[model samples]
Target: MTLTQSRRSGGRAARHALRSAPLAENVRPVRGGMTGGTLKALSDDEVLRIHKAALTVLDEIGLADAPPSGIEIMVNAGARLGDDGRLRFSPALVEDMLGKAARNITLYGREPAHDLNLSENRVHYGTAGAAVNMVDAEGRNYRHSTLQDLYDAARIADRLDNIHFLQRPMVARDLPDNLELDLNTLYACGTGTTKHIGTSITEPANAQACLDLAYAMAGGEDAFRARPFVSNSNCFVVPPLKFATESCQVMEACIRGGMPVLLLSAGMAGATAPATLAGAVVQAVAECLAGIVYVNAIQPGHPAIFGTWPFVVDLRTGAMSIGSGEQALLTAGCAQMHQFYGLPGGAAAGASDSKLPDMQAGWEQMCSNVMAGLSGLNMVYEAAGMHASLLGFCHESLILGDDIIGQALRCLKGIEVTDETLAIEAMREVCMGGPGHYLGVGETLARMETDYVYPFHGDRTSPKEWEENDKPDLIAGARARKEAILAMPCRAALNPALDREIRARFPIKL
Candidate 1:
């Protein structure tokens, strides 16, 4: 009987303390930006084939509707505009820009501790969505997501261990004005979390205001540029070879303002893009390659993510099946293309078509999350709390997603083959001289915290124990945790003086 066994047999208070104790950074079993890339959805030859197809798409089909400024920048960088007014890139030009594009970039957080290193197969999971509604699980209903809801979501994400970053998950429908909406979205997310934030702007004119706001938070223009805590999730292209003119302009402003950009190309198969999964991927790749060219032409080596978010459609009804197996395959395949380009890439995952956080949502969310991690996506966006095919956001789901992503990251960590991990000596000791079992052993006790990730909300109780106590509900557990976290005194994400100053100067809704 050891101290560990004594605590193990102790009541719920001891177990809670043990589970709640934080581990040192070096010893944590899974963490943000763990190296994955073990599962290849596409072979090298297949990757090459898709690469060639994408290049061909750019060379022949090209992209239409680039903003005039974008046209000038790309043209000077060797892209050609044809009589059809479509911007076409030569294979050589695409290759040149790809080579010039920034690699191994860092997405900074307000705190240095939360910075993410984006290179190769390093994987990080986080939230992203434009859900207009918030799910009320207890009421079994939904309401328009408000600025306060967005703030609460960010605050919750700030405390979740497995969620790596915070992106604006829902629209502040309460703020009717677009400019107010944009500013408040940034304000809410930034003020709620010290982690890196991702957001979007409605207009190019709002870009300078955003930069100014960030500067105020960072203390100065140079300081903000040196470590941009927020990035613009710019949907620069509208599927199937077309530039979103306004978004392209917004991209230019944010890029010149020293903000990193996510070159998002969200093409829904069967509606906005090709019905075939491979064709959808090809179009997305081509569009993002053109985006790489656009970003590099403006400022060579500018930080940008190769975001290829392709959604699936049932085809029969034409509604998006965001949690379908096809969606997972699409995300995995897009991640492979990102690896092929050797660029930091992102894709959608963990979104569920199910209206509620039920068994369906569980299967849908886990399937994509696990596959995305296995496929080594650099940024797995919309990886938590998304419901109704991304129309609704749930705070409780976000809390549970921390646990889900922890398990996904453990899978990504895989097996460590080492002398100690081999356990042959321990096996011999247990079988011969020592006890016949490995339980209660020193190695087991030592490795317990470092080698395993226990879910805070997930139950592993025996039937007897479950009956002995009241049967714990999973949703109830997550809701209680959420309430506990939200009840704590909110950490000031920006200095009190700075926050007051900004509020005085601008509309700080949060």
Candidate 2:
């Protein structure tokens, strides 16, 4: 077998072993049980249907100006690229790529035990990356993120059950070297949290370094071989939608290494793309298809995630706005399109252009997150405090986002068909003036734990009690909560020497 095929076989074997293994002592089953939800997880038939839709759209609508390599491959495979640079593919071509695509992935963390399953219906959240500032203890925004800021962020996210993965934002401005900055930040996050660490391979050298770190943390080449790390690699396909060499290289590396790559495209409608929402989405899909083609070319069965963050440009101001309804619709539509390919879909949700925590922020976040969740996205990024595209980050915003996600989770909670939930017998009991008996029952209490997410900051008490407690604002409560979390000791295990090395590599100047 070829190297790629061999790796695929090995991955399948590893996954089987994981499924059969007894649950680890620390590993807890997802609360509220893993079954039943409004988002009836995609089945084989649903996946096939989505794939057919995507193919129809690609062939009928067509795409424009993909990379030469990607275009050449599609043309050779009987696809068509017009003189205007529009590339069109038949349903057969799309089917061939889907048949050879890898649909499931497991992401490894510094702690061998820390991992996540990326499957058709699974959903995971990570903090927004590339943000420049974070709200500090005094409620004042700072200019740059220090190593301390990054570590503290990870610790806070680790304590919250809502955040499934930790991502590296921009490195501290004080760091002299970019390579060391990226590596050190990842090492710190890996050593600081039991949650999986998410990294982006923006450059070829950084991609290699990420692999090396994974190898070291995994205990050697063999362990790394057994469990692969996950990362997202993106490319900028300006206006007409096209890929670049660097983007192609990163995809190829992920395919060769058996890593799960999230192929993300960020397009601003009316500016970098067509002036219409549908036009932007069409161009976005074209760009993603180009990346997928490159991945399939390198390793036919390589694992990947289809991601998009297409935003609309305000016609009056000429600025890209994340708060528009167009943003939410684009995310939902993209999820539908990716489903058509029989691949896991990723999208940005719970984000706003508001610079502060306010009504606009809340509405924008709720709408976007609910849309993505209902649309059946497998993963959602920026599910936290991210303001002004990539400017402000706040603890209160994060807390609010968590509450919004709780509501989204509730929406996904499919109705239970159990005899008790259906309550045919219970209705009769109530009719007989029996008080229904469920309010005081043990089952009700058991269900509450999974059914409801208690708010960390929002007032749940009576008005009198809330007033007596000084009527604290959400921001104050969130700040206090963050402090408490940072004080708690982390359970993550890292080699003493390696920990020292990472610390020494990135020290706090102050």
TM-scores of all predicted structures: 0.97, 0.80
Winner by lDDT: 1
lDDT of 2 by residue, 331-430 (tens): 7777766666657767777778887777788899888777777776666778787776656666657766776776666665545587777767655765
Off by over 4 Å in 2: 1-92, 109-114, 136-142, 169-171, 427-443, 500-510
* Per-residue lDDT of model 1, residues 338-432, tens digit only: 98889999999999998888899999999999999999999999999999989999999999888889999999999999999999988988988
User: Where is model 1 more than 4 Å wrong at Cα?
Assistant: 1-8, 11-16
lDDT of each: 0.92, 0.65
Residue 219's C-alpha lDDT in candidate 2? 66
Provide the lowest-lDDT 10-residue window in model 2: 28-37
